[model samples]
Target: MKRFLYFLSLRTGTELIILTLLLNKISGFYGLLAILTGLHLSSLQLSMYVYSLFALALAGYLTPHLRRQSPIHVLGLAWFYVIDTVVNAVYTAAFAINWFLVIGQHHPTAVRFGHTILEPENVTSISIILMLWGLRIYFILVIMSYARSVLRQHVYSTSSSTGLYRRENPSDPDSGTSIENPFATNREDGKGWEGRLGRAMIALVRSYWLGVDEDDGWARGMGGKFRRSGEAPVTFGPMERERRRRSGTGPLPPPTSNPAGIPWATQGTK
Candidate 1:
């Protein structure tokens, strides 16, 4: 159920943000504000407002523990909330615009023009508000889309490519593994969780500059020179070497013996 909610949040959030953007494009700022006010007002019609308030309180209460779990998950969840806001904004704009137009017939003077140069009337104000709401929604949707795209690319890149090759004998170097089945897992290939994670981090960094190259096939570059077999080795410069020397003992040295049955270093001879 929790996982379902997580996925649902992502999908709904994306859709909402997109819809919000569309609303803003159709409406403007005052329109957005008016729509928000209307939505807030309408909240009195049901227990939605109470539930929303409660949910927020609960989220705040669990925030510390949630943060400790996985910061990435927290960020993903935030993306969903932003999406939801966009969705709400779009809905509010649509509702406010329709209500204003329908109610305007009964009260024509309520739509009176302002004293400003353009003299935008009540109807114009309502339209502008709707447009603004749409625009805000669009902004949030775009940001969320970009984030999700980046995250997906990261996930793909870090996952193991062992699933890309066919089984092969350990001793037979000449017997090449079949690459026909790109997504087939070969346990002998040494591609595991850790290797995949390293690939993912590297892919994330690379994706920023190169963009996603999804068509290159899943195993294309996964087993190449770029994929690390083990944890990356640390390279120390002169400054680091000096710092290490001053800090304490460096890596432990090998054992040695002196000719006179005493350790060479302990003997203190020339």
Candidate 2:
């Protein structure tokens, strides 16, 4: 599974985030430059740039948190990226319609290629638009994959640290334990607005946001998680069961409710 981008191989979410911000800032700079150069801008173009400014601010705030395994900030940034993708698409569609359909109809034909009279500017712009949109789709995938990695990493760390986890049998490999995103729309994270907003933002693409995809395993590495049952995954220091046994305690009990502040699972008393 290829976790990173195919060409650059950007492995971490932080790199993806920084790349996103840097590209957007460059875009913003170009927009401002156009304004300075006396290039007349349509209302739609101006609005699109304005929305990008908001995104830049939000992403900037969340960017620093990308380095940390903090779920709230990471999830916030992921949701922002997904929402911005949709919003940007709508703006792009409007711009494309204006450029290709309305404005192109008014333009004088400049180039003749075989049986068709094609404008060189249109051909070049069309090719560039297609390529940019394709790259945008790939960026969304990498960002989501990285977000999933961070969310799962936090969950695994919490489970190991608190010695509370959900498994059919305590001896089962940690790989069998659930690592669902608590902030996902479907998760019963009883705590207020964060879950609600997550649902609202991701409801349209719930499956994509929450479910596994190609290369997710590669993104969610086995440093402290998802090891085979035989490999004996260790979190923190000593095994929880081993410590309990040495202290003259019986095997640990199953988790009653979601421990480690995870609100996604609820197990019966065992």
Candidate 3:
């Protein structure tokens, strides 16, 4: 029950969050069509629908690159979230105004659904719209939180060979300790989705909301004492330099005098 609650909570996994965003985009698309079919929507609503379509397309293009820690992709998606929020707010207001006016002036005796005559009661439709809007609001906040975390890490974090976040200047001899970025959104290094997806979500929440900044100074002192694990060894050249010397692989040096500075070639000829 506890685990189930966690899953359903606002703090969902990254993939789940993206999935929700995609669904929201799809719903917005269809909702626009429904509104257009039922009534004459203003130019503003039409513009909003076009904007939503563009945002959806941008998100689909950038998602894969964003997962690979591309800063540009992350920034693009962040801007989409912000612009989409404002546009959505405007659209909602417009919708509410139209809905209220319809209820007020066009109070019909009955709404004909094909052959059936049903009493005009928008209560059910309004309630559903409100519920969806409320959920969408929550999702927007979560996405912004996640984006802010990514931006922070992009500015402050360094990359490791494995493409994970590392403390800045990991190769600096005086850098003390190599600290991993706490805000790293990538799944924890391992095999299963549990390690990558579930752990990444938990870590992202902790780093962003719980204030888990990378350990520095005294906490890192002990870690600093251990030799840097991922440092690549410095090699002046090739190992074959010494091996060639031992095996006398190159051209022989010019012949020298045998003894007492006498030339060996001259002595042999004499």
Candidate 4:
């Protein structure tokens, strides 16, 4: 995530994505207002809003999982964001071309004509277009980087839990754990066309999606920031707890000092 987001700012990829997600949520509200105000949106623009609403619902539902740190939900949300960004850009372009043609009767859209399309003029519109696309690319990278971090961290934590249970290696190396590619495996989770699409997405950015980051000084309790008293802190969250309970490896030993990490996960670690 640092690899993708650190160039833009010191904030983690998750932090950046949260801001972008807020932007999308705000834009969705504007869309709803347009519909309610009886604005004349083209069928295409209307269709875009329909897709926007769907993405809005998904973003609303799954965005909280960022705190929950559910691998499947987080990964699903990340992929949804990527798809929405690309699709929304296409819709925007279509609307722009239609509006430009319609306005051509009053203002010239271009000075020179090409094979089928006109050359874009160096104007406010061009600058805005460039800026929007640049931001979209940055958002895409930040999202993918965060998603990969979640996947890798889940694997690492699960490995740590396993070692704590079995007592096989006190200082167990992760050499035994094969990081599962969520898009490539799992008979239930990684089947069908969605999985294929995920694989294609990963194939396009394999190194970034699967690579390790030096800034992964990830510790326990990055999440569950606002848990109520007696509720399980979502540090490793439900996934880790369920695994530990099933394995009969209960709570982690209490910290000698109440350090940064949450020693209690469910009023107890397990």
Candidate 5:
């Protein structure tokens, strides 16, 4: 959906992880449907499992959207993802056991369950299921990777507007309580271990899993720009004001433009 995609664009690091999380949400919905149709369960048990999954999937979708817009929500979202991953893995294992060990051993041939037949021995069906499970496992890794990025951004931020996890409180009353540390050596300076590990994982995933080499060509040109200097207003304003104060002189009075477009200071002459 367009609205869903708008949230995804806000991610600064681990874009693949966000993408996979979205995809996983979609797959989870489908799995929920499959559970309803393909598997047999008691009315109470089925309803409980269905409701549980529905709630979890809803949380998964909402967390990313909330965290994307507000950095303060990232930590809570990370915990949600961690719990969701474990639950999903347990559900996967349960299904795998039912499909292969129990069903395959007993019903070598396809068994009719209502309108749809459960076929555990079908080569294509099994292969498809295995592939989906493998993708799910990889997505768990993606979720962890993104969580680390969120934490890294939360722990250190150079500017309120900059970074993945931007600080929410820009106008705190005690803003001067903490000393600022600016590291402009690299575009990703002060990313800490979480960031470095996330990047390495992303690179590895891109290379081996996605079959694409990371394009570091842009890094060479971008380095100088990031490392050059902070923006003029932020870097120079305080220093210039301090210099004026030290010299016992405030800002020059407004200049008045004459008819010929020449300007003169507004100071009165004795």
Candidate 6:
């Protein structure tokens, strides 16, 4: 239950930040009122606002805890905010259409979804809001995508610059071999799997802090970090491979390296 609450709070905080930024772009109280009034169902809109406020508060309370989680987990939770925004927008549109139909107001003449457009007076406002929402979504997605790419590149670059993701434990040969992001190991040797994992993680952290995209994938200084990529199966460390093998399971294949030589392994090791 605590974990669930923490997750919810993190999600809420992200949403509040986005909302605050969005509100700042608008005029004043009148602008707020306009946006609020544009909603079709007053009660539902009020409920949404209240819920969002509560979520923001909860998020604030859990900020420190949320930060302890992996970046991937945090990014996934933040995405829920995007989903919520889209859902709320849909509901707002639905409510507006119903209200317009009921009041017999000057409905929009534009044909929409096999029917007449609703709420002509507010059509332009609605369109503008939706467009802005799309832009915001795009901006957030781009930032996250860039962050993910940077992290991946950092991992690759730090692991010997071979760009070939490799697993340790040559006994099984293919068993511990891969070409994806290597896992952190904890074996005895300084050259064991843990060392590689530690290096990759450190590089990811450094890249994240420096705002460097080794891949040059996105614009810098966006501060957003939820970028996604094609499903690239990651390489497991020797320990993980042993665990899997002991459990009678085979690991997933490694991701293909970029032709640009995104190094995945150390050069000297056989």
| Tens digits of per-residue lDDT for model 2, 1-270 | 135645554346347556766577557657957898899888887877777777777777888887765666777777777788789779877876655555445644523232122456666777897898888777777777677666655555444433323443468564344335455444455257877765564455555545444544543344445443554455334565676678978567666775566444443434
Candidate 1: stretches off by over 4 Å: 1-62, 65-69, 108-239, 246-270
Model 1 agreement with the true structure over 1-270: per-residue lDDT tens digits? 112124554444444544433443333333335556664445432333443444445434433423243324333444545645655655565665565556555665656323221335655876787687676655555544444443333333344444333335548876544322111233221266534543343344343323334443533434343334573323246866776778875665566744578765667666
Worst 10 residues of 2 by lDDT: 109-118
Residue-level lDDT of model 6, residues 100-153, one tens digit each, is: 565444444533532444445556766887798776675455434433443354
Q: What digit string (tens of lDDT, one per residue) describes model 4 on residues 187-224?
A: 34468876776667666655555544454334333443
Give the range where candidate 6 is weakest over 10 consecutive residues by summed lDDT. Answer: 218-227
TM-score of each: 0.34, 0.58, 0.45, 0.56, 0.38, 0.39
Instruction: Show the lowest summed lDDT stretch of 10 residues, model 3.
Output: 110-119
lDDT of 3: 0.52
Question: Between 2 and 3, whose TM-score is larger?
Answer: 2
TM-score of 3: 0.45
Q: Model 6: how far is 224 from its true place, Å?
A: 24
lDDT of 2 at 47: 79
Question: How much is the lDDT of residue 120 in candidate 1?
Answer: 54
What's the best-to-worst order under TM-score? 2, 4, 3, 6, 5, 1
1-270: candidate 3 lDDT, tens digit per residue? 112125553224444666666676775487587775787767876676677677777778867755665544554565566667677777787776665656555545324332121223456656777797787666566655555455444433333334333434457755432234433455233236433543354354434432334533332233223224565422224654665667998457765556666666576564
Compare candidates 2 and 4 on TM-score and give the better one: 2
